[model samples]
Target: MAAVRTNGERTVNRLAIVSVLIITMIFLAPIYWIASTAFKPRNLATTIPPTIVFTPEISPFVKLFTKRSQLRAPPSQEEYEAAPWWERLVFDGGEKVVRSGRGEVQLSGYPSRFMNSLIVAITSTVLAVGMGTFTAYGFSRFKVKGEDDLLFFILSTRMLPPVVVAIPMFLMYRAVGLNDTHLGLIILYTAFNLSFAVWLMKGFIDEIPKEYEEAALVDGYTRMQAFFKIVLPEAATGIAATAVFCFITAWNEYAFALIMTNRRAQTAPPFIPSQVGSGLPDWTVIASGTLLFLLPVAIFTFLLRNHLLRGMSFGAIRK
Candidate 1:
């Protein structure tokens, strides 16, 4: 009977592993496709039937630095032979001009766009997470009238999709001179990220025993003093976790950024689509740009993963 039970448990564990692997692949497929597409040359990028296995080329990677246009037709054999060594690898202009016949082609602005996203995301995370800590603490510790209603109202903001408010918000931002500004995006992202942040922090604060703060009060610490020295330390894990979510939300936000900012304030999200030229969008450049964009966020998440894990575990624990 014991052997039968052990075999059954092993079977269950194997099934769980299989299920997790399937789900992981489902989530990662698009990311893998994007990375793959980013490495292909223009011709093979959007090929019909989708080339799952094909020769890899360096042309797409080269275009990451310079803007290049598509040709009316493939280059002739003689043109391919006469091409400069570097051009052969990237443009291979051949018969048709590899570059746009129009005026000067400029280098891509991905670096600046990446910086814009990084700055706005970090700023917004700080604002949102800081405000969340205060609001959650207030809700958990202090008595206030209509508290449930206030909490519900806060949560309601997240239910209405950002698309619904983009146009109205755009007009409002323009009138207020907040459009196309880093500060503007920071404030907007903070507002959008606040709902979840507040609730998350509130839960973490609630998990901490009130007795800890009460003891601090008896020892002559004021309510605020007790909060800072006692409650805040125990809640570090939760704060770190909430910060990760806030950062990720602000990092990936697109609708508001696209409608509300341009030029000086534009972020990586909107600028990625702009990489494609007048013709069919170059999958390679777009892919390469996207890969570059994915790296910073990945690095950030990696750095904070330990704190995130602790917070998650603590949040799951209950009295």
Candidate 2:
């Protein structure tokens, strides 16, 4: 009977593992397609039956980063040989890199848009998470009048669909001369993410023992000092987890970014799709841009993966 039970448990474990693998592949298939398409030659990108195995080239990435025009004529052997490898890739595609009157290479707008995304996402995440941490700590450690009502009010801001306020927010931004500006998006994203940050952080802070702070207070630490020295360290996992979510939300935000900013403050999410011009769109270039855009979030999450795992299970077990 014990042997039968053991065998049953083993079978259950195997089934669970198989289920996880299937789900993981389902989630990863699109990412795999994007990564694969990004490296494919231009002609192969749109093949009816997708090319599973092929020689990978960096030309799509080169095209993704540079401005190019259809070649009027093939480069002479002299021009091709003298051209750098990256330029040759462009030439081989029957396109020439756009250059200034002084022959300086002109770059695509993607890099700047990517930078804008980083600036806004990073800045907003820091502000939202920082302010939320302080607010959460207060709510967790102290008694307040109408605390439940206030917390509900905070959380309610996120209850409505963001699109409901889009036009009103756009008008407000325009009236304030905040349209098409990095600061504008940063402020909006911070406000959007702050409530979520506070609620999530409060749970993590609640799990920390108040006695630790009391001990610090007895050691002559001011409340602020105790917070920074004691509470913050204890809540590091929560902070990391909250920051990751906030960053991703701000990074991938679309509608607000689309309506709010144009030339100067556009982000990768909006800019990547706009690469599809009136002509036959370069799928390879679009795929390459998407693949690159995914890296910052992927890297950020990977770096915080340990904390995120801990944060998820932080308060699950009780003493």
Candidate 3:
């Protein structure tokens, strides 16, 4: 009987491992496809059947930085038909291209757009976290008559779809001369991220014992001083997690960034898709851009992983 039970436990463990492996593959498949596409040339990229194994080339990577005038256009039907049979077998029609004048050309304005995204994300995260932390601190410590109701009201702002309010916000931004500007995006993202930050910080603040603040008070600390010196320190893990979430949201936001800014403030989300190399919708450029675009979030997450883990584990251990 004991042997049978042990066998059953081993079977369950094996099943669990298999399940995890399947899920991991499901998540990893897209990333692998994108990375593979990035390394492949246009010939492999636009293949109708989607080539699995092929020689990798850096032409697509180089084309990403070249100017439109400097880049080669798609091959014409005549040009496609004229290719040698052996070359034609491996090279698809879409892969044909050359520099505009057979001369060098400079890359596009990805750096500027990247900088714009960075500014908007960092500024918005800081404002959202700062304002939300203050408001959450107030809500956590104070006993208002309708505290729960007010908290619900604050949360209700996020329940509405962003599209529902886009028009109104756009009009308001234009009237106030805030449209197509960095400050405009910063303010908009901060307001959108505020609700989540407040809710997360409030829960974090509530975890601390009131005795700590009272002890500080007894030692001649002012209310504000105790909050800054005592409560804030304990809430650092939660604050880091909240800031990461806000940063990612603002960093990846597209619809708002697209509509709000036309040229000066466009981010990678909108800008990367429109980049054309050999033809319309350059797959290589798109894949390469996407791979690069993912780096900031990856780096930010790595940096704050410790805080995030602590914040996540806090609730489990608190009781």
Candidate 4:
């Protein structure tokens, strides 16, 4: 009887492992395709069978870096001499025609867009998490009137279709003369991400024992000090997970970014779509860009998988 039960458990464990592997592949397949496409030549990217593997070409990366270096170099007398022709045709032609002693590829406009995204995402994540953490602490520690109702209201804000809010936000930014500014987009992202950050952090904070904070207080620490010195350290895992979530949400945000800023502050998502010319987009460029975007998120999640799992579980018991 014991042997029969042991065999049954082993079979169940094997089935569970197989199921997990299948689900993981399903989630990772698109990312794999994106990374694969990035390295492929433009011609090979669109093949019918869809090439799953290839040796990476360095041209795309070379093109990306070379362009960036040129953008940073100071203008020269020769560059000034061509100003008229440069003005007539635009800097686009001037940069290509005018060359330094050594040959270098011009930096693509995509990197500037990438920089804009990085700035907006990092700033938004920091602000959102900072505000959300304190708010979550308040909700967890101090019982306020209709707290559950308030929490529901906060969560419901996230449900409001981004499209619905976008038009008004666009108009507001235009009115304030912030339409294309990084600050404008940072504020928008913070507002959009705040609800999830607050809710997630609140769950984690609630699970922590109040006794720890009380002990700190008894030892002469003020409430604020106790929070920073005691509770915050224990909640480090949850905060890290929350920061990643906030960063990714801001990084991948497109609709608002597209409408809010044009050339000056465009992000990768809009930039990717714009690469499409006439009939077909440059598949290789698109693939490469997609891979670049996914790589950071993948590395981050993999490094913090254990903490992420615990944070996401919100202290739920598996057994």
- Per-residue CA lDDT of candidate 1, range 180-222, in tens? 9999899889888787788788888888999999999999999
Clashes of each: 0, 0, 1, 4
In candidate 4 the C-alpha lDDT for residue 163 amounts to 84
| Candidate 3 Cα errors over 4 Å, as ranges | 1-4, 55-59, 70-105, 276-279, 301-319
lDDT tens string, model 4, 1-319? 2443677798987898999999999998887777777666555778888776677664444333334222344457676565554222223322232334684334577778889989999999999999999999999999889998998898888778888989999898899998889999999999988987888888778878999999989999999999999889998877888888889889989988889888887887777677775886657666766777767778887876765654454324321
lDDT of 1: 0.79
lDDT at residue 223 of model 2 (Cα atoms): 91
Error of 3 at 222 (Å): 0.6
lDDT of each: 0.79, 0.88, 0.77, 0.76
lDDT of 2 by residue, 108-147 (tens): 9988999999999999999999999999998998998999
lDDT of 3 at 302: 84
- Please give the RMSD of candidate 4 to the true structure: 7.3
Candidate 3 lDDT, tens digit per residue, 1-319? 2443677798987898999999999998888899889878765787889888988766555555544432155556676687545333323423433334654333456767888899999999999999999999999898877988987887778667777767788999999988889998898899888987888788788888989999999999999999999999998878888888789889998878877887787777878766654546778767877877887888987886655644344222332
For model 1 the local lDDT of residue 238 reads 80
Q: Given candidate 4, what's the lDDT at residue 300?
A: 80
**Candidate 2 C-alpha RMSD relative to the actual structure:** 2.9
Q: For model 2, give the 10-residue run with minimal summed lDDT.
A: 310-319
All candidates: CA RMSD (Å):
5.1, 2.9, 6.7, 7.3
